[model samples]
Target: MSTPASRPVTAPATALSGPGSPRPYQSYVYAYPHKTAYRPLEDRPALRALWAREPKDALSLYLHIPFCEVRCGFCNLFTRIGAPDELTGRYLDALDRQAVAVREALGDGTPVRFAAAAFGGGTPTFLTAAELERLCDIAEKRMGADLTAVPLSVETSPATATADRLAVLAERGTTRVSIGVQSFVDAEARAAVRPQRRADVEAALGRIREAGIPVLNIDLIYGIDGQTERTWLSSLDAALGWEPEELYLYPLYVRPLTGLGRLGAAGDAAWDEQRLRLYRAGRDHLLARGYEQVSMRMFRRRGAPPSASDDHACQTDGMIGLGCGARSYTSALHYSFDYAVDMGQIRRIIDDFTTTEDFSRAEVGRRVDEDEARRRHLLQSLLQAEGMDVAGYRERFGVVPAGHFSAELERFAARGWLDTAAAPGRLRLSPEGLAHSDALGPELFSPAVRAAMASYELK
Candidate 1:
């Protein structure tokens, strides 16, 4: 990540000095304008108008399934523990309703097309084989996304990666299947409250490989209690045995309302140091083993087939998300059904989503304006190893990032995190900057978004 020299600073900002420097690990900024920043839309904007002027070609489609067999200790996702036999059907029935409404909203105008699609949730595979087939039908028949043509990715768990469920996904043209194997060590699994034996995880992975899906993704987590470098590598090598096409190495966070949070598990500077050390180890291990780093948490095998479905950046393009836990994005607004982590509140939201007859309007959301949009563009682009394109910023916003984010860039340069020799028209992060992406991402949050996210109630 060599870059141009001497970052310039003409604006004032928070200090990122050597002494008492910010912790490398902050909140993960996977999405700009985090859901916590969203609120109930009193006006209830119609989905029709939301997409009327927005670009529709090459859109990304997502469907959320909020039911999971078991909730992990560190999980704070909007998902319930299990669905009653009747609940799954009710959920799909509701999904079909939402899809039909959304398709109608797209209005067969401006050549609407979905370039990629994903099934995510508590675990999309929580549904039975027949239910999964129905889920795909809802996306293709009702929502008008051609699953067979697009790169379709689905999330599954060790318990739910059953052969029958996987067969449905394969038949429906699933190109990628990601299973969260946080750790292959039984002890670490127990500490994470993700109850499963090594035997079961191995069996599940076998089924995934046997299913003949093109790309397989394994998700591993660092920073579990009682984890050490040796055991971390043990888990890493265990995952390597499957030669997964993609791997996500996540840093565990004991967020509020999660099992670890309830048990008072907290992060300290020492813990941060441990996670950083482990992250570097894991990263280097994968890189040496013929895996290329996509981001801090994602790595792909060197010759893996391109998975464009995962590349639909909502920061610029539009995305359509269905189901209670899913979210959608347009150029000016990001909307979702509701946001929650508490089990009781989550269940309430799921129940509400299942019985609703109308799905024509946005329930809760936040509108993105020009300035916030600029920040998002810079933040997301800079977080990548390739960095942002200077020309693209000017074309979109009529200004260069170095000038708009001068103070932030200067701070990063001072810390040696911003590349000083990147080619002209390119803004990239130094290796260290990508390593501390969690912290760097948060620093770019606009004051209003930061305040809103701060004030949001977890429940």
Candidate 2:
């Protein structure tokens, strides 16, 4: 859920990092125009006007729950560590009000249909079973997303994945439930400041399996301070024992203001090499066990039930994000509430969101012109192992990816990163290319985005 390193700075395309650059593990571009690129709008655009001309069919709906029981060491997502019951209740109430306003904004002029939904954050399962039911209600009755009909995914942590909460999710047709285990070795978990034991993690997995959710996704992190190839494999094997349908292997990134950062532990050349080694080990082990690589961090067991999320690729579809920590995306713009990682600032923003009566207009955002739109499309697609289709790019933009990104593509080819085999019809990363995706993603960032992200105050 957090970016690699969670750093405020970005790599400028002119100085693109390559194999010799100590391996740029400093960024992860899951979505284009990171929230850091956003600025307070001079004139808040009405949501109604924003969606009027955009395609609404196959929209992706996201809800953010910005509360966690505890914060891990390498964390900088837009969530508070702990929130009181009254605060959570207030947050849900605010969510209901916002959902109504957003749904109304997506009028009948365009057919507004959501193909997939996700609840992410500190942890959606942090809410009580009853509260979870209410969350689903807001999505269904207020936002008009048929959660049951659409593929819905929710994120959880080991401590909060209780049977009751899993039951609520299952009943609501949550097709996938991802649990953040971080590590199976108890000492490693503590080293990462995740504060969970192997036994507890096992119990949580058992509960999720019992809940009968179609897809169980286990998330693990490599590159913790003391993590080794042996310990990393131990964690990977432990998670695989559950035969989870999906696995997300993250490289731990300690950024400023996070627990690890405060402790003065930093990523160096050796650490970068260690993470790269462990990543390759984990990737190979999973591939050997019959899992297919979906991206740098994601792997799916072959023939596993597909997430409804697959119906809407985040790169192209319009998305409705309904929380202070979430972001709404359109072809022309990307917007969200103010973002901050400091505890004091996060609570302040959450408080502001809870009391917000006017959800009709966007407060902060970045306008995406044709140049940015094209960059977003290629960056999102080429990072994948499947790569971008030449026809698809041409059909949408009236130009080929090569026509616009010749220099960048040639540089990648020089590094043996781009696969010549796929060139005429498609653009895919070679195995080595996929390994360095974190570096490659930022190389595509527009100069303007780099400047904005560089200036944003992480705190």
Candidate 3:
């Protein structure tokens, strides 16, 4: 297994300029320009077909916990803030019903082998110790008896994690915990509406470590309104001092319908060049401290293996989701549900449910044909720190990457954006390329996708 401290720091690529400079207008539309259209979950016929055809040993799971003590200003995830006692009981009842419904839809005899199971949102720890255990038990019963041995992960806020809560998670098969430690600076934390004190964070970390979980992934955000280069760098240093097994560095995105979005709309917030500089400075600081860039917004300690990287790849593979406001994806379709209804009312209903049915898969193959080549290139490039292997591409896609992306490859090479000579079968972003990596996805998106992404907003 690779350790996180031994990876080399590649320099960021210089800006791709001149007449052929990759135009932002072409790609800056959707959060995921190439994302498949929303498919409703109520389409029973299609869902049945999916269950019948799904490979028995090839599924994963994602469970969402939607209770938070306070809502963060920048958060756009599906979660509710307020009293937990009344909410937990209702949410669990609804979750159980949904699980049963999915099980029945998939059929009882189907053998499901989950590659990974992740608990995310509000805070998995928001549930009482007993409730958490019961939820995991129910999941194990539905998936199989040996879920504990699988790669299980959960996300929690530092303020919600206690020694008891951590112990419950450890006993229930959690191998990793992603704590939302957005910033170590008190002012930044306050600005984000995260009520975590520095002491609270340290205590939470100590408890989680004591529980024997091997991977501790911490999240740090940059490009917020009140954040400065100095504060961001200092937070980075503070996070590193904790020696987390992995780290996710995300640039703050102001999404509509959120507090931050209103601020941006009112001209009180802006993601300017200085914010970009802060992100770059923080990235450089992480790299200098022995963290390897794993994705556009993530870094891990050097020598860490792919398995130890953030759970992004596992998520990409596919996962079954449980709970209200949870999303699930198979090889063919993606579905999600809204679970913010009256918990009291939901508990009374035996068939607790709210779902978006399947929309369309008729164009899947067509879109795949048009976009798969680049999608694979970008997905692999975006997730794996080692970059794409030409031989692997040929083996999987039945064609060399150069055959499809040769023009783009040449364009990057001319600007010193790639180190093509290091190995025949490998292509990695040059340091300059890393700096502008977010632009690559947009640059490669098709015109239709670019247009669709531009006007889309997450609801």
Candidate 4:
């Protein structure tokens, strides 16, 4: 998900240690151009034709549930506040229709194998146990993806991670479950516009563990109002107490249209320094506690079951997204239903999606030009702890990453953000560079994409 409005100001590298280091972009560039760059398709294309030549042997499947119990203040994701009356049933009904249409579009000649699957959104667990079972049925019976055979992950919230819902997930072969416990401290949670008691969070975590999901992932946020180093560590220690399989530490981004955005929290030198300090402290603490860094925000407990293949490398494979907030990627284009952050706009889109009869054409998306594709290939791979594989890039694009992104690579190296010497053939970020991933990601964006994303109108 991309924030529809606001991009942070770029700061100099020298500002890292002091009051003026560049504001952390923390952009979470999971996908290139992001959903915000998608525009309505004037001539929607057939899904069959769109994905005809795309590789399908090992694909990733993502299902989005755009309803949450409460909207977090810093959240700019495309999800509505709550599902009222029969909304959940209606949404699932629409999802079933979408699954049927997408499956038909896959064509019968070649089998599309889903290697991994994930359910994410406002809160997937907000649905009833029966509703979740229906969700798994849509994935298994309708789409023909074997949930039991592949690694499946689902996202839940502290308030919604109920035992009944978790049992349904576990029975449906969910290998991992991620819960967002933004803060253990009630005050900090309130500051983030998320209300929850530590007791509830603990209970939810206990329930998830009891559900027997092999991997449990916890998400934490740093840099919220009234959050101090001591308080941050307390939250960290509390999260670590459960010995989660994975942990994601996110920096608070006050983007436009969110509650915090309305509060007018602008990025500044002091704020940047504080966040960086907290981030490093958290990073070092995790490193010393027998966890391995997967990326700037993700840490994995040693020997924990691998959550899933990081095949979000959508540049090379195909993906089928089955909800309003979900984005599907093909070799040439990325598409989804219209995206909006405002609750009214989100509800409108969801309603429209549920009622739609035509699901055969691509509706809203941006064309992935060759230049953009290379940039994506590099961005998705380079941001990982393992870094981009030089051989793999050459095999896929017929050119070395350095040959195409030499100028950008040189600049990053000069600023000590990337280390070509340590990794040899691969391009990897140095520790200092990884801390500024937000800055590094945008700096690599193609000028055309940057402008296109910038000009998109937000609700």
Q: Which ten residues in a row have the lowest lDDT in candidate 1?
A: 1-10
lDDT score for candidate 2 against the true structure: 0.86
Distance from true location, Cα of 274 in model 4, Å: 0.8
Among all windows of ten consecutive residues in candidate 3, which has the lowest summed lDDT? 1-10
Candidate 4 C-alpha lDDT tens digits along 1-459: 111111122112223434433446536566787766778999999998987777777888888888888888888777887788799999999899989999888877786889888888867888889999999999999988899988998988888888899999999999999888989999999998888899999999999999999999898999998899999999999999999989988888778789988988766667777888899999999999999988878899999988776554555877788888888888888888887877788889999988888788899999998888899999887778878778889998899998899998887887788865666678788888888887778777888777767777878
Report the backbone clash tally of model 3: 29
lDDT of each: 0.85, 0.86, 0.60, 0.82
- In order, how many clashes per candidate? 8, 0, 29, 3
For every candidate, C-alpha RMSD to the true structure in Å: 5.2, 2.2, 6.7, 3.1
Q: What's the lDDT for residue 16 in model 2?
A: 27
Count of clashes in candidate 4:
3
Candidate 4 — what's its lDDT? 0.82
- Pull out the clashing pairs in model 1: 2-421, 2-422, 3-420, 3-421, 3-422, 4-420, 4-421, 4-422
TM-score of each: 0.95, 0.96, 0.79, 0.95
Q: What TM-score should be assigned to candidate 2? A: 0.96
Ten-residue stretch with the least lDDT total in model 4: 2-11
> Cα deviation in Å at residue 244, candidate 4?
0.4
